[model samples]
Target chain A: MRRILPWLTPLVLGALFLASGQQEVIIKVMGGAQKPALAVPDFRGGGDAAQHTGVFNETLYTDLDESGLFTMVAKSMFPLAVPQRPEDFRAPLPPPPRRKDAQPQRQGPWLTDWSAPPANASHLAFGYLAVQNEQLVLFGWLFDVTQQDVSNAQLFGKRYFGPLSADGARKVAHEFASDIIVQFGGAPLTASKIYFISDRTGFKEVWSMNPDGSEQKQLTNYRSICTTPAVSADGTRLAFTTYARVNPMIFIHSLETGRRLPFYNQVASMNATPAFTPDGRQVLYASTASGYAQIYIANADGSGVRRLSNVRAIEVEPKVSPKGGEVVFVSGRSGPQQIYKMNLDGANVERLTTGEGEASNPAWHPSGEVIAFAWTRGFEPGNWNLFLMDVASRRVDQLTHGAGRNENPSWAPDGRHLAFSSNRSGSSQIWTMLADGTKLRRLTSQGRNEKPVWGK
Target chain B: MLTKKYVAALLLSFAILFAAGCKKKAPAPPPPPPPPPAEAPAPKPNPPMITLFAAEPGTIERGQSSTLKWAVEGADDITIEPGIGRVSANGSRQVFPSSTTTYTLIARGPGGEARRTATVNVTAPPPPPPPPAPKATFEERLAREVQDAFFDYDKSNIRDDARATLTRNADALKAIFRDFPDRSVSVEGHCDERGSAEYNLGLGDRRATSAKEFLVQLGVPADKLRTISYGKERPQCTESNESCWQRNRRAHFAPGQ
Candidate 1:
């Protein structure tokens, strides 16, 4: 019996270890239990090549870090020497023999050599930038270190060649980061252009910029108030509200042809907040053509406009779900402004937010799991902050802590990040952050920027 | 048979009574001369007056001008309504009324206020229908005849005050059509910046169409009026107050071909 007991104990310990290991594997496969730790080392370059290297490395790191799907390992915690080439990466070495009388030490680098896997990093992204023929070329690679077999290391690799300009540097980094995201079976943020309203040119006009806030170009020179920009699904046409004469009118500008025309120039009513359906066949917007603000669905060319919402309150800022099955909008039917959801046919009306100062600009996450909106608890000016509510559970989570008025939360196409307008820096500007409300980054610095809408 | 002392007392009482009667009969010392009749108070002047209020020529052509003259007495302030603002107590103003309009002059004084009105009649003689001019130089004249129609806050329905203005506008439009059959009028809708720009666009459209419909109902050809909505984009007044917004929320008329 004693002899059998010793054997049974070892068997029990072995089974327990195998069970825990399997559980971890299952969690990793699901990719929902905990964020995967990612290590982004500085890209290798020297001299003139280093000009874009720093920006490229930082932008890639920021892009992944703000994805909300990764926990970025700090650069300080990396090895003393980073290996930028894929061939330079090596697996951790075996631990040395320990004496019974001595205390046990850590298994890797701290105890032995520096050739070891990073601590708690399941993924590693490393790259190098070089100036080749007057162009900045980026060669990036991502590795999944979670596997025990180091021989099967390559997850994805990308090569980007562009002009040696600042915008080129950001684009290279963004493109490589998008490749890495796609490798993980996630939707890439397709909205490379963010259309916003800026008052930099003396009057509020429609302005657009790269997602990284570079190459900002004014799209309209109306010299009057222009706002509420809506980009078509194909990113070809931009529809916005402009005051060309004495009243606001919806005007569409073709990005390719550079021609502008009025979509609806009815003389007495207001039409604003236009959103194209996923199929790009129709545009849903808010209009007061019926004597009160109501949601209206119209053809792409402003024909066949019909009311979509029947409630006798101000219904504006309509956003159709990614699947085009439902819509969420801002309504004042219950007195104070609140966000509500309804079927695409305007049936099964349900209020999504209640008991607040005011809530507006409800943005549907691309995953269709959550909705983010701007909420204020009181009537105080600059009290608006962002809040995300789970569509099914109705659990509300505040995303901003009143740094300044944070309103107009727009979800990144990835469904893991958001771009919003905040006056936190004294003047309203466009800002971006992860979906979990971390890593706040300012995207605009000039002029008063508001109503940032990320294009699909 | 009475005693001698009693007879003497009775005779003395008789003599006293006879003396009192003689005094009474003598007119009681001529009583006191009658007092003079009470004098009446002098009369007070009437309150400040507007002695004269007149509009010279009284009646003129639709585009012709007239002078408004007024005289006021004992006034600290005076004003004339219908766009002739504050003025001196005794003054004259030359006014051009597109339609028959009554200008009221109000003179305020310490005693009270006196008001007088002078109406200038604008007459458009019905003429034999004229032939259409393809390249006429009446563009500016036609532009002046098309009047703006106003609306209330967040409302597209024409107000009661706007009806009179619209009637005049309709009459002028009818006359224009009778002479120039090819010209058309465009009614532009506008709104105050009190609501969302998109919603205001719809509201402005309704307002422009409402004005156009009214003109059509008043005998103007339906095809003569075209509608466009500006939706609070072009505010007549840039101020953020209600007064400015009221002016912005209107339907403006522009002569179109």
Candidate 2:
């Protein structure tokens, strides 16, 4: 196994760099007995990588909660020990190593205890990376907290020929993680694409392609803010929020028609974040009609007007199950954004995400078992991360290496993969990855794409 | 080396099965619902009126509402009602006055308004349903529900509802005979919107069969009335309502057409 690390290290690094920086998560577990499982990605890293002697610790937690595989716990419910901000978190310039390393760099503040995590999380997979001698090195370990032992660990370090940027260096780390995921017999990831919005086209509009940065195309040409793009269960009809001369309203475009229809008029209010229900019979959308963002349901024809949530809260990104029986949305009822769910008739409201940094833009699986959402690190701007939660087991899995701003996750019709937008590769672009955060790929190569919605 | 490995891995990931998941959104199981209780006397007949909503034209003076009018002519007590502000009918013109109005008009009265103001634009009113045609009463609903012959799913066996339609047909049959004496009456049966159109047509025929058998049982002679099925093509309600479907799920009665 140790001998194979050197040979596999270069392949892992190459895979990471080629992933196109659309999504920096989707790491798999290489060489494992559990059928090659992948970890949940949470892409939320920030700051210069040179600070911690090039060491970046990224954790990819495999969630068996959804899919009836195992129980899951929401990471928001996990007792996380917050880190105190250093007066200067930036890494100080290092002295010449030739000069006896001059003054040794001060040790960074230690990460607090993760000893006893939230309920229902029995296993945790963690990864760490560092750049030594300008060569990237990675090590990963999955911990079974119940047993208080390392369930899995491996070291992978390699050098990349040609000039590679820090983005390429981080991607090398992600591939190593995905390797472990496949060893556990989980579904192989790698076929997905994220659609998001960016101002690269000189205006905020929607663009998309593949998660590995290919086949990029602009879906909307509106000069105004065309933010929300909701994909249908079959991945054909895209319901998105468009702002015309009137207030921001929702609309749908048929991939076959290339024709845009007025989905529903929000009547002078900002109607945005069109999420399709599982049955494709209705769209759960958000509007500013209630003085703030609130969830509302409109028939596929946009006729029926029923409010799904009514409270002093900002509820946006209403995603419904394929059966159209239940809906999960982001609620700001608890001061910060959190994930919550209620039935189609607005009964049995349950809070699933709490205490996480501004949970938003949740996308549900077609099977109605899992939900992927964008999370922010507390008090940090531009630290959007991705997280997953299983419905049955209530287990939370973090899928990213905390790389850069990643948000707006959209799942494909089959629910085995997700697409999201990220700025980790410098400019914002759409990315795709397997549902478990493996086989990371970039679907958009040019322009800025955000808020991807898979087709019907 | 790094680029090659990422390239190779991306290709290998494709070599495996493309990511796919369970295609599950099962249709909801048919729930055991409470059978409607006697259909509740078919409710009072709703007065038909040319109710219209106004669409705004262009920008008018801010804080100034436009006037919209309507005219109804169905019932006697002509009480003109406006959704926002009250309007009166003077010389057949109902004027709606409001400040800062969107020019929206909602009218309710015995006689519906011919002209409706949608915003600041003048709209040529929707043509009213040409003078009131005779409304089918509860007796018509009851008569429509009665079938000449009702049959099992795939069988043309006569059922209970067919007996009821035939019993009612006995009186109507006597009246027809008194008018023409020698003329024969043909019974047409209609099936509800439950089965396929073609299948319902056959079911309708079965209903007609049951009704004809009852007529035969009534000693009305066999060669007089023939039976036919229209199937579920005609619906009582287009909206998604079980009550409407159930109402539609019956054998309709027709003398000829």
The parts of candidate 2 lying over 4 Å away from their true place are A1-194, A210-212, A377-382, B1-257
Residue A155 displacement in candidate 2 (angstroms):
35
TM-score of chain B of 2: 0.36
- lDDT tens per residue, model 1, A1-456: 998999999899988976664333212222465666777878876556687777777778777766667778777667765666666655554555664555444333221122244456777887788888888888887877665554566687778887787778888888888888777766666346788999898899988887667778988899988877877767788888766664455788888787984465433346677888877778888776665668888888888887788976667888888778888888767865678888888888889887567677788776676788888765452267888887776767777887987887887666667789888898889998876677788989888898888875
- The residue-by-residue lDDT of candidate 2 on B1-257, one tens digit each, is 89999999999887664543344447777879998867556455345353434333233443343434444333333343344454443223323333333433344444433434444533444576798887654345335543433444433445566566567767666655555555554455454433322223334444555566677777766776655444443456644355655555444455432
Task: List the global CA lDDT of all models.
Answer: 0.76, 0.54
Report the C-alpha lDDT of model 1 over B1-257, residue by residue, as the tens digit: 56998999999999999988776543344578899978978655456699989999899888789999988998888899989889987888899999999999988887688888999999995686888776544566566776678898656778887898899988988988888788777788888754444445656777888898888899899988877676755678866577887889899887763
For model 1 chain A, give the 10-residue run with minimal summed lDDT.
Answer: A106-115
Error of 1 at A261 (Å): 5.8
